[model samples]
Target: MCSLCGVLGCDDHWTSAIARPGIYTRNTDRLARRREAANRIRLANALLEPSRLKIAEWQGASYVLSSPTGRTQVFESLAHLWPEVEAMTARALDPLDPDFLERLKQRIEAAP
Candidate 1:
């Protein structure tokens, strides 16, 4: 989907939150949820960095996945992220793959 449409959408993906974002009445809950969402993006980027793929929050409701080549896809849920990443980058993303894990570990250790 296009970025504009995704931004206009009111509901967040179920996988994007620990609790529903729209049902809360407190500011603290909103802040906590925002923090959780940012953390999710950070961790996902770690696994994606080797492939030169990255994802960012799209208006707090959806995610925008992009490739080093400039191709992009906007997806609303974590469920859709992997497939989009694979298709956009032309690389199979296996979070559990031994080599991928090793790369991630090395990247983490190498970070200064």
Candidate 2:
């Protein structure tokens, strides 16, 4: 069943198999990617030292974080980290079993 639709799993009565595919799959994929990217970016930002991150708070505005030199180096580092993040997201989106980043890291280490 589609959780959003409140349908039970593998129920043909609720799902229209012959008709055009539902938009859920594509939207779900997109949402998953967005979430994964956000998570990775957040983590990468967290890894920066205080001097590097330079996070600040504003009453109604978003905070900004950057290096002491005004260079946003965290985003540059993200490209190098994206492959691992992609694999982690893929594993997370898997229905059967979705291990968090810890297990994902072990899998990456074990991979050839």
Candidate 3:
């Protein structure tokens, strides 16, 4: 539920809910995509555990950067911030390269 709209899944339903009226905003969309990608990476890291990587409790929560590759990643600190950790991972990795960003920009620009 969104505090502003008092609607469930408002963020999903209204693409520009976080933006000012008639203004351009990519923060919400980018954050969402980053979150999705981060979760996938986190899951993959979990599967590779005991073989390719391992996770230890960091301050009471499971950290995902214990993986071999994760250690080398700039987003390694993401292991400490779960849930919202996706944004950290995305910024660190910059997974959305030029090509993907171009497509995303087009989509957002075309939106009504």
* Best TM-score among the predictions, by candidate number: 1
The parts of candidate 1 lying over 4 Å away from their true place are: 1-28
Q: Which digits, one per residue and each the tens of the lDDT, describe model 2 over residues 1-112?
A: 3445332221132221233223222333434433443554455544333123443322211233444556432222233333433342333223234343455556557758
- Judging by lDDT against the true structure, name the best candidate: 1
Best of the two (1, 3) by TM-score: 1
- Stretches of candidate 2 off by over 4 Å are 1-28, 54-65, 73-112
Candidate 3 lDDT by residue in tens digits, 43-106 = 5454333234443323211234443456522222333333233343343323346754565566
lDDT of 1 by residue, 24-105 (tens): 2232355565566678789889878888888999787778888878888888777888888888867788878899889988
- lDDT score, residue 17, model 2? 28
**Global lDDT of each model?**
0.71, 0.35, 0.39
Better of 1 and 2 by lDDT: 1
TM-score of each: 0.73, 0.30, 0.24
By lDDT, rank the candidates, best first. 1, 3, 2
Residue 21 in candidate 2, Cα distance off native in Å: 19
Predicted structure 2, TM vs. truth: 0.30
Which should have the higher lDDT, number 2 or number 3? 3
What is the descending TM-score order? 1, 2, 3
